[model samples]
Target: MAVIPATWDMYDLIQGVLQAPWYHMVFEVALVLLIVKIYISQSFSPEKTVLTDKEKETLVEEWVPEPLAPDVPDDHPILKSMEKYCIEGQNGKYVTVNGKSCINLASFNFLSMVGKKEIEDEALKALKVYGVGSCGPRGFYGTMDVHLHLEDDLAKFMNCEEAILYSYGFATIASAIPAYSKRGDIIYADENVGFAVQKGLTASRSHIRWFRHNDMEHLESLLIEQEKLDKKNPKKAKVTRRFIVVEGLYLNSGDICPLPKLVELKWKYKVRIFLEEAMSFGVLGQTGRGVTEHFEISPDHIDLIAASLETAIASTGGFCCGKKFIIDHQRLSGLGYCFSASQPPMLASAALQALKMLESKPRILVDLRENCERFHQKLMNMPGVKVIGDPISPIKHLMLAEPAGDPGLDVRTLEMVVDNAMNDGVALTVSRYLEPEEHLPKDPSIRLSVNCELTHEEIDRSADIISQSFQAVLGKLTTRSLDVSSPLNSVQQDNRSLKASR
Candidate 1:
């Protein structure tokens, strides 16, 4: 309120103009006006009109509709089969399906421990203690002490330096492959390897050379080709790793890989060997040590072995066995291991129980081997059915002695036979394949799985039922219908002259 310096007032009341010392005040006024102009323009500018919650939802729904999966028709063969043969409760040597207890030739309970009281009790104990799911991956407090114990049990069981568990059987080899093999690496795989193996190879983005199924000669030729390629580019060969991928027991064909030859090639070519033992782990060998034990080869020769516990072990999940360096790498580098939750503690506990049970009862392996051989011999005597697999293989494919000219007809015939067998209280499966995806499509057949619990009576009954079913179905059709071009081929007489008999 100090009234002074009125002389500093630079205003022209009469002329409405004049400023020099008060230039700062004028500049400030201009700055305030500019800010007001900017605020006015922005405050009223047209952006999109804001939508209400319901309007926003409607717009989103219209713009991005939820997708529906392709419908599988009710009349689909697979669905029809499922509807006809719905197994209730646990699968075992004898499974209850559609209210009938039938001899099971369709289950994977090779060692017959699926519903054992001891294993169930052990699983329940773990379930109560650790709950159901592992809930997260190994590093995230998902892994339990039971999982570690099971890993150790598996490692020791396989006679390997270490082992790692996968929450899923399919993902075991899938994760193991890409963990080591990458783009630019070369993988030599069998033409009949399972779809999971194909997926792993595909994901690795490696250069894959496929050999004929279980053919050592073709594999050696591929190796020789690789050797020649190496000679051509020693520098690239030095940096590039070569891997030989094979199945211990080919799931598609039921034949074991020629391991000794593969091992020889592995050393001769300096390539790593990765064997997927999903089908053979608990079914092969005098002591069930798998293909390695069956052939008297050391597990050390193979770089890694991936197998599922679902087979002979009769449990959930899978595992990889090898020296510590290889398996430990999977812990961090394998996407399946790093991304999927740790296997349920209950499953790990049951697997551990099964492993221990198998160890204690070495005779279980002996029984399985004998049962497989017995079943194979029975199937061999079967007519109109060509048994395609190793004599000792627990999994065997009984293909048509002569293929029906039409693939669809052949499948329908096999499916009919399967239905007939099931009706007679013999549970059988017609082997299925995603033919479009298989490297070499497997021939249609009735797949038979032999379990240790099967007695001589059960085996004989199953074999008899299968043979009868085949005879019932195939005997109705003419050799001509089956497209048989045997010595009885007719000529110039047209279609009518093809004789049935006099």
Candidate 2:
């Protein structure tokens, strides 16, 4: 509008040229040519381009490349060494990779309820009633009637005043750790706490110290150190509250917490204790009430009792149950409780049913514990194996030799062991210690979790598979010198196995 500059004259010149006779003629011709082209290629027209069923089949046949299956390498040391544990499942027995099925020794179905018709029927009914998802976060619209019912049932079953649920066991730890402690709090935890709990603690920016796993003396020393610090910094500190956390049972070594001694320490030091009973809930104690009851202690002694519904409950979710005040405080304080999505209705329903069954029929707990003991006895009797933890708990672990402080097994080798058992129709989790030092008998060690569902025969067979797997992977190394290096060298021979182990 303000008299365009000479440099802008190019715009007008182009506009004038485009508006000339030739431009219009070309545009008209181009439009006609496009129409003709589209008419000639009617198969590719917008209205007709999609393929018919016959054409799609023909194209698929013509264009799809054959899938090349992965080949197992010949002369592979791992294959040669792991041959025994390379098993498959068949006829209800866990089979070797060569297809010899034996009794299953590896399954997490603790109550042996997963494949039951009644359980399936209940699950189906719940699914039909609640659909597949909760469709929203618990803080918004996710909490259904089922969620509340399960929470209430769990609290009652655990003999606690309150309980809060999370999507999974680890999620509970991740959400709860940071929620309770802060920058200035001192968190004294057992070395065996799960990774998720550590993550939570790390996020909370608290001063963290690790006591030896289940070592009451070490815990006392840590408590003394924290007390000394507290007295030293009485006037100028960030915030206060000493949190002592440990697992009710150690998953790696299949061991239980020293509840009496730990509780005593807590009483003397006046420090709070958080026990993650991922494996112990619904299985330990006289009434299936867990370590709190097993030790004849009340919920007041336990500042927090965190557990995964994935284990004994035969469902998916996690919860922390304790005193109403602590539970309520944690509800607001835990990010998982306040922010994360709650468990779905079907899972809640199933968990509630499982909890009710565990509570009313205490026989289930007895059966599970008996099954665990049976398995422990069977495995410990086997050649080249050492069993850890209380024989009565369903957490029998076969400790193996590491050879010169070298941890002999890793995730992949363990996975191979799992695969071998799975191929044989048994499903079990292989727990490899995070550190070689931890695998010491006095320290943490590699472990396998046993539950009640397995029969005596199944336990015997599983022990066989485990021993075979260890022997297959570890060769002739003695379980005693697993504290040495032979097993490490054996594992190192197979590069792929080594990589997988990590």
Candidate 3:
């Protein structure tokens, strides 16, 4: 009811509290009932019971994992057999692991060039001249003489007009790629390109498409699709450019890029191509000039060749090389180039020396190839092993196909292989590529790298240890069944088995 100023006294006289007490009581009882109903409704009711007690018990039993204490005992046959490859301190021939001496096949030091006397002396001199680190980002104030020298040396070695450096190998992909394209661009990536490269492309706010692992046909198809899209929209037609990105060698399968096919594709579409030569640069080609050189294709054939000097050159940092306009454009336009810090003077100088060394004596690359071939043949000859990749590259993969249900087999098997190799006085980093992905099995495989400095005897010793590890794993697999077919045999048969012309 409305109260007027004239009826104020009458309103105050009315029993409003008494009039609302019954309604207030009803509302309170309704709220209490509603809360109770909600609490009961959300609980595990009879209607929600999908299983009987007996079935529930069985499901619980199935979900429970097997006891690890019994299978992984200290005196376990698997553990006792794998301790022969351990080493104490890695020198020219061996490395130290868990207070023991062992031959090392696990390092990425392809040329075994990191600890050389002359290179070390040069690194020391640069340290004295330019101090330990760059004071700021390259774009702001850190570019130095050694930095320029390294870029020049890399340009000459890769046979490009110019080259630019990045402090980290992975950052180069992440930073440079997104800057090249925009919302209207179409990116076609390799199936097995490095995760960093894929991640960079995926992170881009632009549209991207993927091709099958080294499938040139799929790449061409995707390019055709992009053309259709471009033709439909005048806006996209003006800005949409196709870019094909891939690695020189896939880290997972140790498969080398089919450079000739890729080059042909580049010419067909007149699109840009970015090739990551991280694992192939210092290990392939006649003069270790990388895939382009291995195929006898000129640098002009490739729009861009990106690589990490740390892998084969025995130095730290990464570089991208290409034509003058391309290099200059990236230097000014690429966020990674404009924002990242320059390579340290010492690291830059070390890279320069490594490039010169590689050029002056081509024997290092040849020796590296020979070492790779030796290891691959020896491993393949052994019972129950598959060697992945071309015979020319130092990277090789040894996979285990059996013992299916062990969830930790991927890590455990790698640890077993690495641990056993170390005990036999052999050092090798177990391949981690396949194990980490959900798409891959728990017991993936092992990866081996034959350093340029490895001698025949060292290779034989490595073979023996690898054989021992395989024997141990095979014995462990006695409890289960395995399907073993080498991936290398498939790769070899599928594409014309063209021998890498060295």
Best by lDDT: 1
313-376 in candidate 1: lDDT tens per residue?
A: 8888899999999988998899999999999999889999989899899998888888989999
Find the 10 residues in a row with the least total lDDT in model 1.
486-495
**Any runs in candidate 1 off by more than 4 Å, and if so which?**
1-67, 479-502
Q: Native-vs-model 3 lDDT?
A: 0.74
Q: 179-233 in candidate 3: lDDT tens per residue?
A: 6766667777876677668656865666778788888888888878767766788
Q: Work out the TM-score per prediction.
A: 0.83, 0.70, 0.74
> How good is model 1 by TM-score?
0.83
Ordering by TM-score: 1, 3, 2
Error of 1 at 137 (Å): 0.9
Candidate that would win on TM-score: 1
lDDT of each: 0.87, 0.70, 0.74
Residues 1-502, candidate 2, lDDT per residue (tens digit)?
6887996789888888778899787998999999999889847446558789999899988996656986767854455546645554331223244555444444445665554455557778889998988877777888898888878888877778988889867888777777778887889987767666677778889988888878889889888877787788876543588888887776655678888888788889888888888877777888877888888888778888888888767778899888888777876778777776778787787777777677678887787778777776776765544667788766655554342333334444555555555555455555533342342333323455565656676677667776676666555333423543565455555645656798
Q: What is the lDDT of candidate 1?
A: 0.87
Q: In terms of lDDT, which candidate is stronger, 1 or 2?
A: 1
